[model samples]
Target: MSPVEPFSDDSPLGASGAEGVRALRVAVTRPLSGERLENLLRDAGHAPVHFPLTRIEAPSDPRPLARGARALLRGEMDVLLLTSVRAVRSLAQALETVAEGPWRRPEGLQVWVIGDATGAAAARMGLVPDRIPEHFVAEQLLEEASSWARLDGLRILFPRAAAGRSLLPETLARAGATVTLVEAYRSVDDGEEADRLVRAMGRGELDLVTLTAGSQARVLARAMRGTRPALRCAVPMVAIGPATRMAMVAAGLPEPTVAAPHTVEGVVAAVKTVAGGLQ
Candidate 1:
């Protein structure tokens, strides 16, 4: 992908002069989906660092998901909460393995998405959400749960990564809802890439770091902690959503620029805004 472009106005680092520009480093911690953020950062004249911390892995057994799909069709699930596009895509793929032709989403199913992207993913599966919260986090989702009061006795199906924080499930359970947690996928570490990131940070070669998800932020924090040079780098971080921003903060990384709306375009806009403010 092309590097992120600079802001239309002077960048924050640009105001600092050549020395400041040299110190402006960015490190991308996750695999970028589009070129908007990268292009914006590069245009701003900052050296962009691209380091993907984890690789997405499909589940070893699709049987559970297949069963979940069958249950969903039978109206066993009252609500479907999707937190990520990956979860939707993984569930769709799993469904195809056991289901023939186009599988229709059951009616009367209250669908809730954590964000717009996840909603779009659900739309791809021919399922539109009943509600979508503004903040793309489990806390936000829980707070918005009141909207589905009619779904009181509902059985909610949450398909997510195998290993992740239990906030969503725990919160739903506390809300007096039956939540079924399914491991749709997993994220595996990339050691070689982690090493490259550490070396790049040590050399002060990175410019802007982008974290698309909370899981990615956690992976990055772990990787950085393992290397002192990476920890000492002063690269600015860009979080795609609140959860990611929280992860960055919890990891004690430098304060990050959080994207509004929590979308890819929002992230790109945040980079441009931050870059411009830098000047």
Candidate 2:
């Protein structure tokens, strides 16, 4: 058998069948994830261990975020595109920083989010989530947005992380929308968190590791640097999407199981895919 096995396009739960499988200890690497992903894994009979390897911080310059918020306040922007829950909260903080409380959005502005978590964050902020794509990737969000509204001459405000992919904004620009891409927050590596993860792998405790973003994969690979190559590749890894999978490979790690739909639910299902494969 190959040292690092890969999964096929089989149904996620196909191997479980009528019999039960052993629960896996899945290391979830998202920062401040809390119980959302954990509870989902437990409900599926898997033990999720918190191994946060990345943390979010405010960008060095708040001017761009402030400008984006001010544009929305002044009704200068026609659309708001949020890619992550962190982006939604960061942008909202920028709004409260610029104006008084209870500042409502311009009625003409349409709000669209990428993930269920992003939409939920918007709803928690008392903002209506006008649209959310069925899939949680930027491409899906762009497709869904284009399907509903005319992108021509639209002034769209995209509040996201400092190192986010440019595909969404670039594609929107090509589609004739003027996109204001703001770096609302930045994801930084947590040295202590990385140390803990490396320790766990050394102890051989983790059955699988989950990667949500490219940063997480890169951090993990960097953290595990100098360790035995086989030790790092011993456990299977699952990524939330193609970008993350590519990150895993580029980080000198084996290719990861890419989640379909790229949602948190899809991540849960990916873990199940690994579980079913083990059985």
- What are the Cα lDDT values of the candidates? 0.71, 0.81
Single out the weakest 10-residue window by summed lDDT for candidate 1: 14-23
Model 2 Cα lDDT, one tens digit per residue, 1-279: 001112233423223322365567778888875558877876776667787788888898999999989999999998898878888889889899898777887888888888788889998886778998887777778777778789999999999889988899999999999999999899998867877877777777778889899999888888888898887778998999988888889999887888886877888888878887877
Q: Report the Cα lDDT for candidate 2.
A: 0.81
Candidate 2 segments exceeding 4 Å error: 1-19
TM-score against truth, every candidate = 0.81, 0.86
Identify the leading candidate in terms of TM-score.
2
Error of 1 at 27 (Å): 3.6
Model 1 lDDT per residue over 42-78, tens place = 5555545566677788776766777787788777998
RMSD of each: 4.8, 6.4
Model 2, backbone clash pairs (residues 3+ apart or across chains), number: 0
lDDT of 1 at 42: 56
lDDT of 2 at 252: 90
